[model samples]
Target: MSRPDLFKGIVSVAGGIMLPIDQTLLPLKEKAILIYHGSNDDVIEISKSIQDYNKLKNIGTKNMELKIVKNANHFLSSQTFKDEYLYEWLEKNI
Candidate 1:
């Protein structure tokens, strides 16, 4: 069977697969990166987020926060504390 050409141009790099966020060479200008991933996400693997967070820390990313919500799916429906967390983080950072 032939492979589907899904997200060809958008999710690719120089005719190859795009690297994950931590593996990419792009510079991040944000003062802080708040990544929230569900532990039970069915779409994206939780390992990817953990890897990214570790890589960010290894590369000395300032104010990098990773929150893993338990029992939440891809939409994080089980975790609804984003607003409060965001507000507090923003207040402290900005």
Candidate 2:
């Protein structure tokens, strides 16, 4: 999808696929923060995070099912989050 198709407005589109883990309200709240960024540096950090996610996902079974959302940034905040498309995709795949 085009970059424009990713966002609902100005925000990233990947936000919807998240499982609502909030890191800001952590430890006490037992939340997992979804880190979001808009720069190249952030992109690199996010890529590393995704790699880490893949690693974790690989531990349970010999065959791993991995889905990488297209055009999504580190926080999974693509423009696509504005609609239910990403959610539907995740529901179907994950």
Candidates' C-alpha lDDT: 0.55, 0.36
Which runs in model 2 stand beyond 4 Å of their true positions?
Answer: 1-44, 61-78, 90-94
Model 2 lowest lDDT segment of ten? 24-33
- Write model 2 residue lDDT over 1-94, tens digit each, in one string: 2233332222122222233323321221221222233233343544554554444344432222233455555555444365475465445533
Candidate 1: tens digits of C-alpha lDDT, residues 4-92: 22211111001211365443433432336677777787777887777766766666766667777777777763354544875676666
Number of the top-ranking candidate, with lDDT as the measure: 1
Give RMSD (Å) of candidate 1 vs. truth.
10.2
Clashing pairs in 1: none
- What is the C-alpha local distance difference test score of candidate 2? 0.36
TM-score of model 1 vs. true structure: 0.62
